[model samples]
Target: MIQNGFMTLWKSSIAFFSLLLLGNLTGFAQQSIDVDSLEQVYLQGNFAPADSLELLDLLSVTFQDPQKVIYYSETLIQVAQRQDSTQRLFQGYLQKGNGYARLGNQVDALNNYFEAANYSDESGSDSALGSVYVTIADTYSMNKNNDNARDYYHQGIALLRETDDSLSLSTGLSNAGDFYYGLGQLDSALIYFEEAGPIFEALEFRIGIGYYLGSLGMVYGAQDKPEQALEKLNECLEILEAEGDYYGVAAFLPFISDIYEKQGKYRLAVQYSERSLDIATTYGLKEQIRDANLQLSELYEQLGDPGKSLKYFRQYATYKDSLSNIGLVQQMARLRTNFEVNQKQSEVNLLEKEAEISELRQKRQDAALYVALGIVILAFMLAYGLFRRYKYIQRTRDVIEKEKARSDDLLKNILPEETADELKEYGRVQAKKFESVSVMFADFVGFTHYSEKMSPEDLVKTVDYYFSCFDQAAENHGVEKIKTMGDCYMCAAGLPFPEKDHAIQMVRLACDIIDIVSGDGYSEVTGFEIRIGIHSGPVVAGVVGTKKFAYDIWGDTVNIASRMESGSQAGRINISESTYLLIKDHFECEFRGMVQVKNKGMMKMYFVKRTLQGAEEVLLNKTTETGE
Candidate 1:
């Protein structure tokens, strides 16, 4: 319901409070150590490297000035490197990235973020890596790179949820909601926002609650529930203002402007827009400044104030250009970082060899003293070794990915995707009874007698060929191929999961099987013909056994399907009355009146012909004839 036609409000969604719940630790430390006192101690050079890094980390996020944050972050990095603290190094790079992001240098921001990821990986901390992903997602979202934002958001959430970092998980959820909110996906936005709210409440994080409520409010406003929206927004504003989050306050006020703008209240809209502009300018929130300016420009134009509109429009244009995407720069940075990360990795092998070679050279130094020759030879050996290693790693990765894909395909071949997922996730698949499903059975007319005359290879090849085509036919019509018993192929539609058109799918699959064996010169080449039978009724379906479990169906429906196939003539698809009724309008069928079926006594049967193909085909034919 949140249409893109409305004023963009604050282009940046997600409050600082909700952006990094991990940074709340830094926030807490800053509170305990007064800024003025910390600044005096830091300036006096009285603190140890650890204390200095800690102070710098606190000060980096404390200031609203991006330049100051960047300055502090660089110092933090130096001290952290001196101490060999991987966690500190990650934090330093992260804070630097945040600074660049605030200054609207997206390329530099992304580069720093990727650099932070190196240290996060080095630390092998899920929480740290998750935080990095969330931060990168925020940057991507700010620049309107939605696909990257969505990918990172999911990645961050996946990792964070696996750890004990509730705050990080909640923040990821809230930020993801904000990303969806920006894209005007209100329902998805609401889902994440609702999920995050309870987590923040349980943690008693007031600022998190404020931001969570604010996003929830924005989603509601977009949904056209003004009263509910205003209530939450007002509550959010109160908490944020109390916490003195100037950027947060500035970023959200324009949302109020948006509601007013949509309501056609130009004066009220302009008032909230001006309020946001004032706060953004004071706090140096560039994105919010741009957004508020743009909002004001449109509101003024709505009110016929051309002079004010033009002035604000120019400001909007200036900030927009500065904040625009630098995709090429980012791509180059990404490539450079990827190469560096690969070289530094433990699995690279070359680095370990270099270290070993260095130790060997040191031991031989006194005996040979061929330093320059050794250097040249070592360089040549390393270059060749590294080249080979890189090629090996690339090939290995390609092989692994291909094998993984093949393994997945093989698993899907053996079982339904949903069932496979369940089996993998829980180590078992539960049997379920379907109220209505379409079971199908197809059999080669005389496989046993023909196999006695044919060679073993020829028999196997013919069975494989027919079965392969049958598999494709089943897949095409969304039917599940349960198994093949010698000459008989058993399948079912709507067993693992219920589908509305299971009967239709089963019938189409049966016809396709008939076509494959009878119509494709297959009979002439292989001397084989098939009969297919379909019945629609209730059945139990699942994977059973342990050593060589198979996905199979049971009950009277399957038995009747087998009977139908056994009684059917070559080159024909036989169907029970249950299936015939479901496909009556879709395909042409010949009613055989009543027939004696074993165990079931008497049942109405039908023989299927070419597809009537349902109402869609009729409509297409009519349209083609009239050219309308």
Candidate 2:
């Protein structure tokens, strides 16, 4: 027991001394890597292997525990603050952002990149700005904010172009091309990759060239040019192999495998896919690992190896699921952040509204407090002023109202009252679909001879007197005046408002017009008489045009109505077969068999003689029986 206790005590003593020595050595190492020296060494690009190793060692010593990145960043920030060159400070921030990105702290990385970009922009350093934009784009890309990443890549490319930096431009172009490729815009992807290839080749940037070639090859494959795809992919493989870039080689192999798979070369597909997976696993490329697993899964399934297929498929699904979960987690985080941001914005808006409300309330309170005091002093002046103003306004408004009434009456005279009402309510009225309407056409018989016999003034008076009689008939029969052309008058009924007796009313109006012209009021011409026609059918009526508009009816109905008037005899009311069918039972009509109407072939015309007599006929029959 004593021996075991002594051994324990001795082990503890030795461990304590070893820790003490380690602490002393660490402190000494830290003192050697002073902030000034670090800034100077990094600025001059004089970081040798040993120098980097020493800095890394000193960092370990400074952070003796597994400290948060913020703790380490604080130390770096202090060192950066002591540096005189803005370039060094930007580099410090960029490096810090990259570290945060590696640690999956996207917000911190974004903040650092933002700061770096601001400093670079202010300093007019194109290269620095380009680097900052690239870093920011990478962060956004990691989160699959493709839109933001694409925009930042474009900005970076523009900034790099200003510096004539081929490498930065090539990188930016490659990234943009990759984004386009992912979005399935093969044309855009090809253009950007082609732009990047020349620049990368000029700079002898082997990795950039490989990436561009691979991307171009994929686009070619997507474009269904297999031969071109194989050529490009082979060239990419050659470059990747020569550069000994295992990660790049791994990446290119999968693309080559894709070409083989597309070509139905399953054996080659399996071989290349396995090789890519091995290389990727060795190099710890998670992306290549995932892709290789998926490719193998498809290859195995194609080869009909169910067991192997299932194994690879499981691996693929597992890794894919993990990646998907990670994406979902990141998406959830972003959504939570956005929700918080929205909540804060809402609160800010609410506060602003509250402030406005408070300001209004204060104004109202002040106005109320001074109301009694101001009213007594201002009453007499306001009352007299208001009275005179009111009187002037009242008189002016009365005149305006009278003028407005006159204008309204004029409008009613031009259009039907219902149409005027619609125009006023809707500001502008739409054309109505009138299912059916009554149309009438009237022309004076032998008016030309009558006009020749009279003087010019007398001729005008004679026509006016005739047209006035027709107008009165139209008004009595509830017909809307369509228009009068020379001595011919046309009127329509049932629109802009519809009526059940539209056809009957139109027939009555026609008879009235004929009767009035044939009466003793026809002294201007001894044998003066008017021929009238009426028809009823579907018509479209609408007020057309913005200025100088008129309501017009169009359809077969109106055309037939005009034909009826043209086919009428003097002093006769002619109607088409359709009109005769509707009004024949109500009125006495003589069927003028098969009148040749234009475009109507042979139409049965009727001469509307007069309305039927029921009560008079019954009375006459009873009297005849009684007398007999």
Candidate 3:
């Protein structure tokens, strides 16, 4: 069976953007390149600016050795920097990233890509930005972060779409197809490659056209259309071989072999696999070598050639172990540590030599030495005082910054931004009497008994879950949440800033609050319901305490709201007469008659049935498909 073997590695390093960057350059990149000849020419250093960049671009894309690619890319970067060529600089960094990506050094690869991104951004060329993003998408794709890969691909393609750069846009499209191809979405993969096909053909970009054909071939192979698959694969293989892309040739040979193997043509599969292995081995393409060996081993086993299977399996294992970058990582770590140790030793030796020179000078002239020593002492004391002052200033600024951040966080989290700003300016919040304000209270029905059945952790989680929903409902309807006391949630509107439709807003919020607990899964979730209440009247609102500040209201409105909640039935919204009168036009309410409250005597209350058709709608996360 076909697998995601070195397809990821192949796409990550030698994908369309690799050549896309080269082809877009205004030099010899559009022509066929003899990379060995170019390398020979580069070895005989110091050419004209244009010629050097052109040669480097061609060699960067054609080089089979990743280490050599990196070395040349560094030289390219220096040349670009000296010439102040943004385009060439971008290509240099991108080539370095591609080399690292090929070597499985993702950290360094991403670092170089981001460095290229900075240049791309500064260049303000959408095509440049798109190319880098596509490169980044390849790296992320190879890493199997599918979500980030898709996002980056979309960003790259979108940006490329806005530019007149057909070549770069085609690169983004085909690579995106490769992304979906790896994900096994054959149809999606085909669509992208097809979309990119005409662009490549129009530009006469042979490499791009080959990749497009190859991608389509793979999709057809996966779909079991062997005739079409073989035709496309063979056509693309010819193009790659002609272009001297040995890496692509080695990578695509296995795809052709997979198609033959799936068709039960064992001999043809073996021939193709061997061909891939030979080329991969010749070019030192480690990933392709391992993949080809494994493919042959599996094919041999299927053909009943146990001896060949065992031999190829051993070879595969050997390459797999040898190809791991772990030892390389450790070697780098060792080099870094040794460099640091040597640096410290050099510093120590320099200090010792300075001390010896000072001693000799002191022995030569005692009076002159004393005078110099006194000057040094005075300078040292002055430096010490200045250093202390600097330290003190820095410490004070740090403390102020930290305290300011903490205070800002506390203020914004606990209170509203406007309220926080007012408190900051005045150092105290004055109680303001709002003529009309709507207050709401929602309590979980039978929560006390529910808590008894659940563990302490589960109990808190349950309460928090329901209360959080209530808070969201309140916030969505322009209701300001005051606080939550255990299972009860309190909020108000028209107080922090007066809203004319506070009563209507609160009623809609109450309906949403009921909706949260009225779901079909509600009984299974908590085995309980919620009771909501609303009232409207004058209320004095302000921050109450100095240490533990609370923005609370003190009036009959708050009391009535609490009484309404207490008098409410399970899964119902109870409203005081004052609230009903204000919201009657907006909501349907059932008269519940005058109910006697504990301390406040009898009060007229009504149950809010549902909101009117033209009224404000509830916006809770628990809102259903039916719009209930």
Candidate 4:
């Protein structure tokens, strides 16, 4: 079982890498052109420079055929050299680099990228140069050359910062975050993710937001914060669902399933894993398919379903062998070797270029070299300015963190912890039904007359004082304080997670609220008494309203609980018959017979006097005896 669990986690992480890399590549290829249309245009005689550039652009973004990409890029270079167009020449070399990189020819890819870089530099196109630098950085990162990768990443980021290109900047930040995350530097990873999140949100880029949230979820999962992981992942799932991004949805589902499995929710785990497998199969996401099979296999093993587990394990083995046959390992080894070779060749090329520049300098004695040197110095100064700007942004992030915490605190006060997290993540919450829940309501008796006698501030303060106490009491008993309306306070137990002793817990909380409102200090100061009620049944809870969010419950159970409070007298706790049965053994109660409830008709009621003399000790002893 432990081996199966480890395999599940390993496969899921592989799926995450595949999804993240695919997302980055898609972002890099922002604009796609129709290959067929471009091919038709290229076939016509007397093609213009724009036509050749368009064909190269189309081929660069096309990954289905690397050979076709190489062919078209080579053709574009010939045309560009004939026209003597530096811009088109840069495009040709860049497309060739992309093509070779796709074919696992890193040596050729790096050479083409460097050639493109020179042309871009000659043309003074910072945008083109920044792009080339990013590609080179990506290649170095792929080859595990961390130092070279970091240097190129810094250079690329500095160049793009000057252009004010938010798209490239966010992508760069996300890539850097991935780098840190791979190294288990979670703090650095979070900083980059936080910086990129706002940019994606501002742009309303759903795919980018999905990727960011997914990455954040994985980091949280690695840190063993399952609740936080679920929150972020569920939000990512919602976005992908809305955008009809089946591949993204498939990638995230297995992680969520693993979280549920860790939480001991086997039913939910199986549900999510099956969903992931279904979507992955439909979309032909091979990595996700393998991950889902492995996850489901482990989940079923945990659930004691050996037959299903064996079936999925067989499927997992089949796909594992097929993927191995695809030579992913060999390709990686070759890429690293090619990168080393290319690095040496690049140094030799740079020396030859310097020798040519020296000969030209001796022949002409022009100021061009001096101007070039000055530009290099200016670029360094600009890079430094950007670095300082980044530092300022980091400082600004610290302030934002404080504000975000404040807002989160305020939100938690208004909603349950789990519900608040869901709202913050998805911007909405769906109503969910709890099978068995205990609902409680407390209302101040005769508050209308007291309010008329006192000033508005005094009445407000009085209510706040009592409700604050009620809040603490509810929290102490492990209950959800749903909301307070007017003179009434509402709370519940046994959801978002169900509890077997929900009724007992709610009764305890109800007693605590009654004590607070009826105590001598409160009665003398505010001249206020409160009636409390408790009922146990089912209820549906969710957040309502877009502008002013409120976590509330609706159902017959809630209505009955409310009716119990309104029908009871001051300074007493009333409960319905259903709740009475659950707590009768733990508390002393008096039968009130049938009471006339508004919409509930005749319902049996009981007055909970107090805990039986030995009941508290019995409860504590039972808990201790059970090792609960």
- Spell out the clash pairs found in candidate 1: none
TM-score of each: 0.50, 0.40, 0.49, 0.42
Highest TM-score against the true fold, candidate: 1
Error of 4 at 575 (Å): 99
Q: How well is each residue in 1-628 modelled by candidate 3, as lDDT tens digits?
A: 5455534544544443343333333322434556677788888875775788777866776675689778888988998898898988988898888788778777798789889988999999888888788878877777778898899889989999999989889878888998888888888988899999999999998877888888888888879899999999899999978976676688778778888888889899889989989998898888778778878878888888877886777677667667675565454444434445697875666677679979987787897788899999999999999999999999999999999999899887688677888999999987789999999888888877877778897776767777777777777777888988888889998868897878978887877777777765333354578888888999998898899997888799999899899999988889999998987765677998889997989989998776444333433422442365
Considering TM-score, where higher is better, how would the candidates rank from best to worst?
1, 3, 4, 2
Q: Which pairs of residues collide in model 3?
A: none
Q: Tell me the alpha-carbon RMSD of every candidate.
A: 25.5, 28.2, 23.9, 31.0
Q: Candidate 3: global Cα-lDDT?
A: 0.79
Total clashing pairs for each candidate: 0, 0, 0, 0
Off by over 4 Å in 2: 1-78, 99-111, 317-628
Q: What is the lDDT of residue 74 in candidate 4?
A: 87
* Candidate 4 wrongly placed segments (more than 4 Å): 1-50, 62-123, 139-145, 241-247, 274-284, 290-628
Over 4 Å off, model 1: 1-9, 13-25, 28-33, 318-628
Query: Per-residue lDDT tens digits of candidate 4, residues 88-199?
Result: 7887787777667655566787798889889999999776787677777666665667798788878976887788667667766766676667667899989988998898
- Displacement of residue 162 (Cα, Å) in model 3 is 1.3
Candidate 1 has an lDDT of 0.79
lDDT of 1 by residue, 1-628 (tens): 1235334435454533345444444563354456677677889988885577678888876765678889988998988998898988998898888777777677898899988988998889999899889888888887778899899999988999999989778878888888888888888988999999999899987777888888877887888887888888889989988877676787778777778777887788788889988988887677777777777777787788887877786677666656665564354334444545685563455566579989998889754767777888999999999999999999999999999899789888899999988887898998888999998888888778888898888788888888998888788777888999998888899867798878877876776777678665444255578888889999988898886878888899989998898879898889999999887866778998899999999999999876536435644754675597
Tens digits of lDDT, candidate 2, 375-400: 86699779999999999999999999
